[model samples]
Target: MENSIGIHISQSALFNWLIIFFISIFGIRDVLPQETTIKTDSHAVVSVKASLLPKGLLGPIDISPAVIPHDQYPIEPQSPMYPSFPSTYDPILTGRCQLNFSNMASIIDKTASDCSAPLASLVGNVICCPQVNSLVHILQGTYGKNSGSLVLQQAAAEDCFSDIMSILASRGANDTIPGICSIDSAPLTGGSCPVQDVETFEKTVNTSLLLDSCSTVDPLKECCRPICQPAIMEAAVRLSQRESSPLDNAKIPGKSVGVDVLSDCKGIVYSWLSQKLSLDDANAAFRMLSSCKVNKVCPLQFKDPSTVIKDCRDPPSANSSCCNSLDIYISDVQKQMLITNRQAINCAMFFGSLLQKGGVVTNVYDLCNIDLKDFSLQAYRQQGCLLRSLPADVLYDNYTGYSFTCDLSDNIGAPWPSSSSLSSLSLCAPEMSLPALPVSQNSRASGGSRGLGLALTLVLSSLSYTQRAIP
Candidate 1:
């Protein structure tokens, strides 16, 4: 296969790069983040729209829709960051499905971007798989709008599932969504959930409380306040028994039985709500729930940093060697993948503790003045993406392939441990207590997203976008 590569950099950033280039040509030192205010307040923050476009993730380009005009799509002239697509390009679709793909077009576009070819394997566990599962529930609701069925039957499920994969493949989306997520048509068939019908579920559980708690979800406070999750758990527990079964009246597991049974019941509960609520609301609520889970932990796997510790064993009073090593190490970390703000904290704490154990007595973060954004993919550490700790989703436009929001907090330092840190600290605990590090800016903002304005978010799987993609 031949490689078809293109980059779409924002016009403003390209102009800035040119300015830096010219300054260097005149022999004047280029001013950088070293001149910005080094102090950080994670509390006072705003989101910057950042797009981590998967440059080569979709594999060899498929120019299926033959000849078309490109200028029909109206967007600010982006030089070379996102790959441009035809605004009017149409995909070959299956006509047998009950749900009109036209109405669900935006989400279908997002699915393609989230589950793109190369990205599926890298971020399948955290981003890709979870999104696919959410999409399924939403699709179920949309499909049964007129019919009022919560779950699809065996034959209908097979046809609709085929239609979905077909549409995604026709676009540049990855075809391996099922295998990558370890899912099957089983979810569409209601899987192990005993209560497949809406009537049984509504009658068995307290539908009123469930609807009140989850009809509207707050992405920011839901995880901490936890109104919906507790309600869902309560409903699922009750449904797990359901008094009796339609199959054989067999007694299923009780509330305190195996976790697997309860989990199945939770799926049923979601399906029940999907029928009761509108499609958009279901999508939003499901994505927000996913956001809560993904933002909780560090998704990147850290390698042994024997070399970074060795090079930074002592601070040099004369040369820039130690700081040089520190910068190089951080740059390498930033190239791994896009990370959430909360994950950045865990990553920072982990590397700091490692250095301490390795005999690097001094705090390298202080010495170098490395900001929290330094640990994420960035252009020279200042123009970086520290993903917000809220419900973030991959976006798709007629022009830009996929984009997301990132908090552009200025020069937030990575918090060094006062002593040793236990890995079991729960910053998200309801008490909001920080028994590890002393209370400060780090404690308050560590588990929270950037306050206020939202601009969309994407945790990009890989950082090979700027590099040329060849196969």
Candidate 2:
């Protein structure tokens, strides 16, 4: 006021100066108000906010420490523990029986009047039906018989037995022998129906069917029936496991092939089918069994290991025709191991492509998804199939930050960690922490205190202030 150079020394300017001086004094007073460094209880604030606020959807979408507590300091009997499976599709402990013709007949008979009726119905429907009709839909989408709309119905039906015979006939198997050709007018058969003029009957049936006369087809179920489901399944398992011959004796230890009855029949069936139907046609039936698409390679016939190295000249290479067989093998193995349908399909599809490289044979386990690993963890614990393994502690904490219903008492006696402990760990771990840190900010703030800690503290303070201000 003493050095005022302007005519602004009036009442308004003096009032403004007084106001500014008082504000400055009050501001400094507020700045240093208490000098009381009260460390904000970040955890308490978070707990309170979490308890009060409504949780969003992404909160509980986790796969670990699947169980959570209902209250702070969970009551002993109130909270329960849960288990987890690494993968939704883990392999079943029980082994499946191989599907055979009789088995197939049984399945068909269970659904229909008899095997013949169902078979005939399906065949007739496939043959007479239009391209995009129900018959074609079921075959294409559900139980496929062959790889086509409907054109291959007749050819596929004939080739089913033909392919088997072709393989057998190629090895000196003919229709003139006793055991080998038991279907040829042989009353000495032990099974349901004795062979009655097997060759003539087969030829007559083929000719009749080919001519589209619909004459009663000869019942060749006897050949498939005598094979036995157990034996067939065993054979299929062995064949699948076999690296060389489909029926190599060396594979069946302590047993010798006295006579190649099945082999001879297989050869004859193969020859007949190969002649009547094209290679594509013969493969159509096989494709149905393996569920492969047409023009797409199908699983190969299982080979025997011992004789393969000695007698076989053309061994399957990585790029050879045998890759499809390997693909099927890998797919089957995955099916045996995985339980989740979608996951199993994914694995089958993935490995189907890799089998051609021969790399899958050595690294099958590695090719599997993390879900499979989860299942393995559960299987090892032998706990009833829920929450196979404890999820990461950090994951559990973050997961419980949202609304959830957990039963911690389930594993009371088990030496498992508490949900709280898991939550703490999850909070500590960067991968499972809540309110993830921004990468850019983290990179820019070098040598600064952890951003998560600062961000969480700031959020809690803002929330606390806002609540106080609201009142």
Candidate 3:
């Protein structure tokens, strides 16, 4: 029984050892598959995370088998990448938007409100921006730097940007303030005045004067009234820009040229006046042409003969002796016409009055029947009437055509000689003889008496002639 018991125990121990070996083999197989799965999943998760990163952050570390081949996956050109670069951009927000004053102001106000900054700050920023800076330069070139500066200052000082916008909206895009600023300079701000501007101003003044009728009577006063002050100011500014001394002082460059310019202008004005008024009137008008002052500079003022005489209070007087001589000559002509029984006495009177009033005559019948005061007899002798030659029919159709000569002479100072006789007679001595009449009450009526009286009165009035009478 002891032997049998020993045998069973040994078999049981062998079976237990075999079962343990099989369990160990199955456990090793299961652990090997789990380890392989876990390793593969972790590698896949790492590759996906690396692919999700930005190209800038990811260096040259591609792990794909297809990408590892140098010939197939060659390096490609790439754009520069910066981590701090902005994600988005807006032109208006950056003050780079192109717009006019009104639109710019509106946009600026909107930007300021959105950014929580003041209107002044927004305007300052906008004006200083690159885009706006270009616009400012353009404005400066067109309207002048002084005007640009003023606009800049005004914009910066405004409490409400929208207010300026409204004002800009009301004006045209190209409209500018008149007389406040000119091209190349604005005199109010001590800016440089261009030579072209001065020339243009002078031309404008001259054109205006030439068109005015009153300029003939008082050229300096009438022409300079509108342009004098502005012209003077501009001249001063121009001189200052050249760093030149005063106009009177001779140290300034181009001083003589400037003086000549002013003198030429004065000459033109006075010359025109001389052609229109009598000598006495011209003298008086020139005396009244004093230079105007602007910014302490008097460019138009000069020491010339007329000004010197006026300053000395020795204005020239009209020639009273010449006037007396002309009066005597007129009386002689009238007596001769009366003795000759001429019919042209009324025509002579009409022309005589024109010369006495204006010292010149363009037409014979222009001053007929026109009342005149301050008639200068001396002036009448100096400048005679302009008479057009009468038609042959009119001259020869008269009753005295057989005896009267129609050979009208322009020599007003000397007498015209008769074609039939060698005797000479004054121009006022009519060439036509009186008509013969029958003795009757109707023939010597009121109308005939009035006509004779008028003819006689005209012959007795002022009558004189000029050596160079215009025909």
Q: How does each model score on lDDT?
A: 0.66, 0.26, 0.28
Clashing pairs in 1: 7-80, 7-81, 8-80, 8-81, 9-79, 9-80, 9-81, 405-456, 405-457
In model 1, how many backbone clashes occur?
Answer: 9
Q: After superposition, how far is residue 108 of candidate 2 from its true place, in Å?
A: 35
Looking at candidate 2, what is the lDDT of residue 391?
11
Give the per-residue lDDT of model 1 (tens digit) for 34-148. Answer: 2233334766544432243365766897665434344545577634444554233355555666778777787776777776665555445446667778778777766766765
lDDT by residue (tens digit), candidate 2, 182-234: 22211111011111122422433333333221111112221122222223233
Regions of model 2 farther than 4 Å from truth: 1-258, 290-471
The alpha-carbon deviation from the true structure for residue 298 of candidate 1, after best TM-score superposition, in angstroms, is 0.7
* Candidate with maximal TM-score: 1
Q: Which stretch of 10 consecutive residues in model 2 shows the poorest summed lDDT?
A: 458-467
- Could you give the candidate ranking by lDDT, starting with the highest? 1, 3, 2
Which model, 1 or 3, shows the larger lDDT? 1
Candidate 3 lDDT, 1-471, residue by residue in tens:
999999999999999999999999998976652222223644753223333447666467657643343333336632222111111222222232222344234333322221221111111211112122222222222222222221122223222222322332232111121111122212111222222223333433443433243333343332234343333334333333342234323322343434444432333333333334443444333323321111011111111222222222222223323333334434333222111112132223433432334333222112121111111112133422211111011111112211111221122222111133222222221233322311223324533422222211111013342223211
Best by lDDT: 1
C-alpha TM-scores of all predictions: 0.65, 0.16, 0.15
